[model samples]
Target chain A: MATLTLENVTKRFADGDDEIVAVDDVSIEIDDGEFLVLVGPSGCGKSTTLRMVAGLETISEGAIAIDDEIINDVPAQRRDIAMVFQSYALYPHMTVRENMRFGLEESTDLDTETMDGSVERTAELLEIEELLDRKPGELSGGQQQRVALGRAIVRDPSVFLMDEPLSNLDAKLRAGMRMELQRLQNDLDVTTVYVTHDQTEAMTMGDRIAILDGGKLQQVATPLECYHRPRNLFVAGFIGEPSMNFFDATLEGDELVLEGTELSYPLSAPIREELEGETELVLGVRPEDVKILDEATDDHAFPVTVDVVEPMGNENNLLATFEGSELSINAIVDGMRHVQADERYAARLPESAIHLFDRSSGRALHNRRIDDEEKLLETRV
Target chain B: MTAAERTESGSSEGRLATTLETIDSQRAALYAVLLGLIAFYLSPLWGGLTTAFKTQTGFVQTTPLAPPTPEWFTLEPWELAFATMQGGLVNSLLFVVPATILSALLGSLAAYGLTKLSWRGQIGILVLFLAGVFLPYQSVLVPLRQFWSAVDLAGLLAFAPFLAERADLIELTVTHTAYGIPICTILFRSYYKTLDDEMIEAAKIDGASAFGIYKRIILPLSMPMFAVTLIYQFTQVWNDLLFALVLVTSRSNYVVTQSLNELQGSMAQEYNIQMAGAFIAALPTILIYVVFGRQFAKGITGAS
Candidate 1:
């Protein structure tokens, strides 16, 4: 096992006339036995950074070290890391057994008995023993992915780097393989750095996700931290499903006046103290955080014109317009609500669940109160 | 109006029938044209085969399309052709087999080197091979002959195998082999260009070295193209008359085409035996093509 670290790594490619920085001064520390995920959208430098770590691409500036040893000049074969590509990159002509045995036979000085045992163990671990004689072209996509992973596992490398290994599988198979990978990573405890553009996969698989955008690191935190306390608007807008709702509002004392409707919210003590004469702020709320107020109850609620209501079985996602801006509010509503289009509904926001961001900078106004140990424990689940 | 409409409807029906009959006649005419083209292309081979069996007197008397009588069908021409054409048959085999094999091996090696290897002079080397495609063999005859003579006069005869025993068919065959490589290499290289790069990359990741990949993966995959190159080179080498005449000075070293030319020279009036000898000379190439036709098609199509 080894701890892989990237110190101020950068990659640049020529774009027409200008040099486009694909990865910009990115540093990430992957601990032993940690499933660290590098997650971002396409053109966000996540894959480029992963390729750099795998030694497939050269770093323009900075050092990459595994276990504190600089591997700038080390070839991929000598780096003691095995990678699973997005395409699987299985030798199309070779059988599963031969594909798995290739790396071991090439890299190791193992005898025939040990090599055979390792191949058998990897095949059994992947539950592909019956498929050992079959070529990759004959196998299904999921089976090919398993063989790809088996190829990596049989090597018993210092680190396992995967670039969207499950992206090609179907939804059901992807989920199954995700769980299988988690179990395998837990069992093997190798330092694995997975790169993916899927936020859901990042939230479900990563021990700590390093989010990137436009070649810059945006936020590196546990999934919950990234969701609950985003460092910037990009992270906030990127992490969650239906995404976090944002509205331009003025902080009139403790009340936010949006589209001529005023809703009172008790700000966190630190934010309240910091809001000295600051007239503008962005109000952020998750879909699940908004509560639907009863008709008769007079709470700190604002009226929104419900334009479209999406019934998601258990919860209703209401796409409503608040003060001329489109906002989607998700609330747990019972069975079928007789809410018509263009009808005004009152939705209440719990002050504790409200997130405040600076209007111009889009940075979180309040810091999280949870300790690192608690956050770590929460993420381990 | 009803009485007038009945005559018009009957005329319309007759017009429709005429149009249908005209369409059917045109379709038959189209088929006839297609058959005529096919028969026109095949007429020469048909005539040649029939002429090979006919006696000289009957061949002159009979019309080209007429069937031979039993009396006119004689084995005398076949026997004379085989007995007199022995030197040419041996010469063709001596030149064609080794020349074809050598050209294929060297050409594939050149192609493999150009495709797989990284060298500074690769483009120059490829262009050098491609230059052979445009080069006229006749233009280089004098220089090549002078070069061969100079080597012989300098007592470097043993150093140059092709000229070591000038009278021997085998030694002269090597000269043709060397001359045939340039086109073969170009053909093989063009075929190799269609192969998928992913296969090569996968083999590399599988820990195959350059040579190992060529031997285990590329050679097997390129067999079809190799067969095409062999057949083309074989036919050319087997049918070559100019190179045989220039290089082989003796009757013992004469190739099939050279021997046929000599047979025609000696027996100018014996048209029957000449046709039989021509048929004999053409058989090997035709048989080789028929045997390897599938591979030749696969090579051109690049199925693998």
Candidate 2:
């Protein structure tokens, strides 16, 4: 319903004589009705950022605005926002009906009939109408989750804030609720700020993902963009499962020599020119993007010894290492592909699929070159 | 067949028999000791109840443990005891109920503020409140008496001077409540410390003001804790003889403990009347324990 802006918001906590910055100055402008996911590793200030927006935490610097109106000084109750906590925070003594009706009663001055109508309608939408009279202790975890969602939806606030709301559920139930939440947000068209440490949730649920690390904003982009073209090394590693493999190298003439190995990748003239006297560079590539070849096909393909092979039902995740080197690289191949351990296989880090970063600064110099089909998919999305 | 099927297999019955055989003599001896201890504790209560029912001639003839015989039993002692205590009972009731509830409610509020709401110097204030819990009443007796003696609450209320006698009970109620607050707040704070902070955060985001969150969330969730504090405070205030003894000299405003003490003359005489009065005075607290003991136990254990 409204656009949310976090313009240079920061949070700091004081301990003894030291002031520790929990969330550094980071800014993100979310469009109206957009689903923005704040995602990072533990202690990365993602939750702090979400809490600052929810007014549960005070901002140590900068301001937050809703619909172009400053709400930095607004108390939480007057901010017109609803949050779904990880534990759901349901009043245990109250029935599901009362839980849904609570926000309406406290935030809105709606009469009894209007409040009941809203509660009933929200319960019906969540398909929890039959559970209205049941207390939270009596309901299952999934049912309690639905009731939590119903409570937030019943308020119809300007924005929705969810903090790892699906983390407490089982895997199957969490996946189901993830889709259901997306549908609900789409139907309601409410601005949402979801916080999670799970990269899968960030990748699948967010309209745009904001990745944070060490209390600093790394990137804010669509999931595909973050995957294919991470703004820096942290986003590349943090946004993917079994994350990206990084190799430190130095550019010398037309060759990028990976340290601690004899392998040198001969980059094309154009890519070598793009290095622009920057000898210190990092080579980054996704695990899935690394192709396993039957034999060495080109200088880009290096024969790696298979250290270990993990057979996932849908894909095979292999820990492949450069021959006689301590460094390891993960590659995911088709589950049906025959792979073995302690054997050499040619694994090609294609120039088109590789990402290059300035080694010292951790800033990306080049990203994966997407072809026509991915371009078509991007346009369609 | 079901029994025979387990004959060749390891069985719970076999394990039970082995356990019983190994510990039979010790277990029996332990039960005997526990039974003797139970009887020892009940003997005095039996003596008190029987002595309260016996008439003067019956009391002189029979031992204190002897149950009342139909020929010797009479209602005279009970009646005399009730008559002596009827006024004190009413006066005590006036202060006890309000003091118990007010102290507990105020303590709960203090606990919520201390644990949930953050402010500068909160830790210092909590330390002070905890310090009050360890402050012994015997140490403060003279000052407590002097403080109430100088404060005329009737004049403060602008009431008629004739009502001043009844107003002493107000002073007693206020004194009990004030003294009761520190311990009550400590007990309630331990319980409130277990409540999740996220619940308050959620309520805040749901648009509930501070008092509203307390009313809707904390108060409803605190029934067990309330029961624990109420029973605990009730016992403390009702059994208090020190404060009641020092503060009140007028028989018109004497609490039940004072009245019971007054029933005992210079010498230990009229054992029957004293026993009856003591039993009657104990009935309210015993009734409260009987009704709320389970909840009190749960609340106490949950706090730990």
Candidate 3:
């Protein structure tokens, strides 16, 4: 097991007259045996950061260490790490067995008997034992992916780095491989850093998700914490499904007012003490957290005209326009009820579910709960 | 019943159309066979093989349409063909063996350097080599002859001890090798372009040095092209008479092409021995092609 750490790592590329920063002063620590995902939109430098760890890309500044050993000058072959590339870079000429046994034969000190045993075991584990003699071009996409994984497993490296290994598969295959990766990671217990632009993959597969934007890391926390409690506007907009709804609001005398509606929320005493009179704040609420209220409860709820109702089987996605801001609220409604367009309904926000952010800095007003739990664990130990 | 019978008759007419189309195809195939026999079966090269084995008197007396009778088939020409006194077989091997080995090694090296190196002037170097493909060997013969003389002058200055004994003979052989390398390099470089870049990168990341990558990966994967180059260069060097005639004056130094030319010029020429020498000169190239013909076809198709 290995704990990987990036200390203020940065990457820059020459762009004619100027340098373009791909990864900018990003520092993150992944614990031993933990599955950490780096996710963002395209050109967000997640792949660059992962390549730096894999020794494929040179770090322009700072250092990366595996198991507390600085490997800045080490070559990729000596780094003792295996990677599964996005293209599945299998040797087209070699059989499945040869592809799995290549690195061990070329790099390791294992004997032939032991190497053969390991290859068989890994093939059995990946359920590709029948495909040992076939070439990669002869197999299906899912089978090729399994061979790529088996190649990594046979190495038994300290860390396994995957660069969007499932991005090439169809939807059904992608979902199946996602579950297989999670199960395999758990069983192998190797520290894995997966890079992808798909937020759902990051959220569903990661033990902790790191959201990046403009080459800087915005937030790194558990999936639940990242979704429920984002640290900044970028993270808040990036982490959740359909994204969180944001509206311009102003703080006034223990109340936040937005869209001509004044809703009161009880902040923690420390947060409340920091808010001054007549300050500007952004009101944020997740789609699931907003509820459609009855007509009698309109006093506490804001009325909005529904623009479109998207039926997602288990839940309904209601797109509504309140004043000038458009809000997309995902709510679990009874399947039998008909929700028509242009219907005016009052939407209510629970006091506990409302999030406040400083409009100027776009930073969250709440302390992260994961940090509190880590502190408690440190004290207990 | 009348409408149903009419519909069945219409379907039978469609089946008759399909059968007529098949008969048309068969008629066209028969015409193609008639044309093929006239084009290939009546060609001179087909009759020349049989003529090569017959005595000159028999070849002149017999009708060309018939094969030689068993009594007319003599091993005398074949026996004379193997004699070293004519020097035709030895001349072909000397030119071919050295030229084939030299060109294959040089061409593959140039290819490796062109594909793998990161130096400046790479395109300029490649363009220079490519320019050679456009020039006919005859166009550069005058300047190339002068250049070989200058190289001989420089070699004599550099190796005075060795050159004092037989400088002229040594200089003639060196000139032949110098003019044969350009087209061979171009052939191998073009062939190397079809290989995947990922395989090279994988070899690099597998801790292979430059030479190791070439030996283990590039060379093994390039055997078909290498054989193609060897066979092509062998034929070119074997058939070359202009360069050998200009460079080599001695009887012992004449290549097969030059020796054949000399044999044609001698007074009271032995027609049977000359025919035997001509067949011997052609045998090596034919043998090589027969051995590696499949590889040659595969290499040409795969490289493109």
Best by DockQ: 2
Model 3 local distance difference test score: 0.74
Q: What's the C-alpha lDDT at position B191 in model 2? A: 87
List candidate 3 stretches off by more than 4 Å: A246-283, A293-296, A299-310, A321-346, A349-351, A354-362, A365-381, B1-210, B223-253, B259-304
lDDT winner between candidates 1 and 3: 1
Worst 10 residues of 3 chain A by lDDT: A372-381
Per-residue CA lDDT of model 1 for A259-351, tens digit only, reads 344445445456677655565787777776766653415444666677787777765777765534454555545546555667777777666
Error of 3 at A67 (Å): 3.4
Clashes (candidate 3):
0
Candidate 1 i-RMS (Å)?
A: 3.5
TM-score of candidate 1's chain B against its reference? Answer: 0.84
Candidates by lDDT, descending order: 2, 1, 3
Give me the runs in candidate 1 sitting further than 4 Å from their true place.
A14-18, A248-269, A272-283, A294-301, A323-342, A349-351, A354-373, A376-378, B1-34, B65-67, B74-163, B166-206, B217-220, B223-263, B266-302
**Residue B90 of candidate 3: its Cα lDDT?**
65
Candidate that scores best on lDDT = 2
Q: Please give each candidate's TM-score.
A: 0.79, 0.93, 0.73
Inter-residue clash pairs, candidate 1: none
TM-score of chain A of each: 0.91, 0.97, 0.90
